[model samples]
Target: MQITGVWLPIITPFKDNKLDYQSYKRLIDHYTEKGISGFIPLGTTGECPVLSDYEFEEMIEKTMEYNKNRLPVYIGVGGNCTSQVIKKIKIAEYYEIKGILSVCPYYNRPNQEGIYQHFKSIAEETPLNIIMYNIPYRTGVNMENETIYRLSEINNIAGLKDCSGNIKQTAELLMNPPKDFSILTGEDLLFFLTLTMGGQGGILSSAHLKTEQFVEVYNKIKENDLEAALKLWKPLYDFIPLLFKEPNPAPVKYCLEKLSLIDSDEVRLPLTEISDQLKDKINSIILK
Candidate 1:
């Protein structure tokens, strides 16, 4: 629907290398109390790639059960295979997800036209609203503004998770965005800057720790208090890098565990747990 405000690309917590649905539900309860606007289960923070199909479905099922439509839930449905991605989207539709955050295909490095065709097909295939996720670093192919604008023309292709990391591009898009197109930043570190550039909000992992403070930043900016928003975002200058020091959800999951929101800070393979040194650094700051 209208996807705006701070959404958590929540980590899929693991215990003994198994999906901890109990802990997962508990984490949602915690963030719900924190007043998070929505949840993005199975996103990068959710360790989507490593999860098996069964785990993926079970996770979404659990998330939906707990969420109970309390807040919007955007399922992460992305893959290099257009058919497979659409398959995943259809599966999510079974749960009646509020929306889908489909990433630009990774590894294949599709040409701009290929990117357009891929998302265009998805929009055609589903009645569900889609938020195109453009993280060129991960996908290896940038969805240029023109391509994104073209996709935006499709009625069901709702908005974007702009992780292009190019200020000029983000600013230009914001300057004259499509009607009802929500431009939410996927970059945690750029949340403040993105808002200043007229972004809707962010799908942030750093938000796992200081949830209310992040919300406060958005509220301050919406109230047109840049000074107050900047004050709230200042501390994140140091904290954001640390959350990403190791790799995504690893650092974030570690923080959540420290706060007793999750059972463990464990992550799946290809992504190790956070380093001891970085853990100490995080503990030193948060524990203080």
Candidate 2:
């Protein structure tokens, strides 16, 4: 499948401090109606780390049920432990999740070679298409472009989620990538910027609000209407910094909640809910 266009790394909603399945399903329907390209569940915005294995499986199941496979579904399948990720990859294969968003192993801080071997081993275990997620700031190490190129040699290694926020890295990878290897940006703030450098598209958290606007920006640029596209995106530019004011999903969840798309303003532990102060700021900007 060509993994292109505007995708939302959706926030897993919580109600009464539990996985809010109904509310989350409502969101899936909501964004689909709003014209998002695809949905990415259990991603960073989904708070994958905080979710239990059962919750992870349930979230994927619910998301699939809601989307009805109208769009490609790529479930996040990365963790610090390779074996565990492989186990879930097997489960996803059985469950038939469309693709895998295997993030760079977090907290372990593996070296370039280790990261290469780590993904290589996991790819050997599953037959599904794999998209490498490289968020150096969060994973504590950047998956170098060269290492990424090397990994791309492995069959079924589909694409990448480049979140390093370094345009140079993106440019380099785009300059020399394996045949048909897609590159989707993780930074919503850099969505349009990344595309200018020849990125395929983005799996953005911010697309939760500005779905059509972002898509319009992408379409304009794709159709060679740079000026009109930039003008359309100008109003949404400030949203990037504002959405990330605290942490991911927190600010995004707050926005979805404010729009009454989800039932709860709640989040799991370790990632506290956005403060009223930030909420006011988000509201003010949202109003303006």
Candidate 3:
């Protein structure tokens, strides 16, 4: 499937230290109507690391069930251990998902060759499309454009969630991307810039808030209506940063709860609720 348009790296909701399936299902129903391209659950924005194995499986099952094939779903399956990552992919494969968003191995900080092999191993093992997520700030290792180009040759390797945080590197890849290999930005602020530079779309966390407006921005750009796209984009440009002003999903959950889209704004420990100060700021923005 073509990995294009505004895919939500969807936030997992919690209440009383448990998965809130009610809210989760509600979010799926909500976004499906809002013109999002797809759903990406269990991503960093979904608090993947902190989730228990049962929670992980339940989230995938619920996502598939709740989504009901309304849009494409890509589960986040990645880790330092290749075997474990592959195992997660096996679990996700049971669902009718479009693909997996696998991040470059973290903490161990593997070299370029190792990074290529890591993904190559994954592509070889699964029939599912792989969207390699390269976020140097989080992973501590950037999957350089050279390494990415090498991986792009593999048929099912599919696409990238480009969050390298380097414009030069992003520009180089967009300039001459491989045929049928998508380059979607993971960086929310760069959505407009990336699309302008030939990117397919974005796996945006900030999109959870604006929904239709974000889709309109992508549609506007694709229609070559730059003026209209910018008009929609400028306000989003300002609003996106606040969601990340605190640790992810926290601020996002807060907004969702305030809007009554979800029942509560609870996130797991090590990612507590957003601070009252930050909440004030976000309330002002969203309430406006």
Candidate 4:
């Protein structure tokens, strides 16, 4: 799976505390029309851990059903435990998922060897292709470039979701990794910078506004149109900070709900909806 292009880590919808199926269908159509490369459910942005297994499975199934093969649907099967993550991977394999986005094990604080061993085991255990997700801030464990280089040698291990804020790590991985290995930046604010620095593309939350912007950036860099590309994307760089003002999916869900894409601004616990003052700021930015 050469995971290239804008992937929205979609928000879960709710109405009267039940999963909002109809609203989800509408969002799928809207995202597809925006030229989204794929949809990732149950990710950090999707509030996946908070949802029950049935909800998780239903969201994945519904996304695939409504997409009707028009856009690829990648499922997030990551957890802190190796065995648990593998179980989820099997489920994705069962669904014939486009790709599996596995985050670096969180809260465990595994050493470099443990991290390598965990991922290596998964890559070899099955014939399924995998995308290595590296977000040290969220996970409390960082898979360095050396370990990543080692993992890159694994045939079935496909690409990486590069979310670590370290530009040096990202740039080095881009410069030295395998020909088929793709480095997709997860940072919405760094979307343009990453492409300019030679990344494949981004899995950006902010791409919701104009999906074409990142795609356009990718095209410009591909065609070597650095000047035109930079000019077009310069305005967006100013808007990203506001989009991430609070915890992720909060601000994003706010945008979607107010824009009438979803039915509610509700997010599960450990994460909450944005405040009214920030909403004013977000609206101000969107208007300008």
Per-model TM-score, in order, reads 0.97, 0.96, 0.98, 0.95
lDDT of each: 0.89, 0.84, 0.93, 0.81
| Best model number under lDDT | 3
Residue clash pairs of candidate 2: none
List model 4 lDDT by residue over 153-226, tens digit each. 89988888888789888878877767788888898877777777777777787876666776777778778899
Which ranges in model 2 have alpha carbons more than 4 Å from their true place? Answer: none
Per-residue error for 245 in candidate 2, Å, reads: 0.9
Off by over 4 Å in 4: none
Q: How much is the lDDT of residue 105 in candidate 1?
A: 93
Candidate 2 positional error at 254, Å: 1.1
Candidate 3 lDDT over residue span 44-82, tens digit each: 999999999889999999998888889998899999999
Candidates, ranked, lDDT: 3, 1, 2, 4
Error of 1 at 159 (Å): 0.9
Against the hidden true structure, what lDDT does model 1 obtain? 0.89
What would the per-residue lDDT of candidate 2 be over residues 1-288, giving only the tens digit for each residue? 557888888888998879888888788887887666778888888888898888888888888888887777888889999998998888777665778898999898999999999999998988888989999889899999889889988888989998886888887887776678888888777777877777789898888887889888888888888899889888878778888889888988888877888887787888888888988898888744
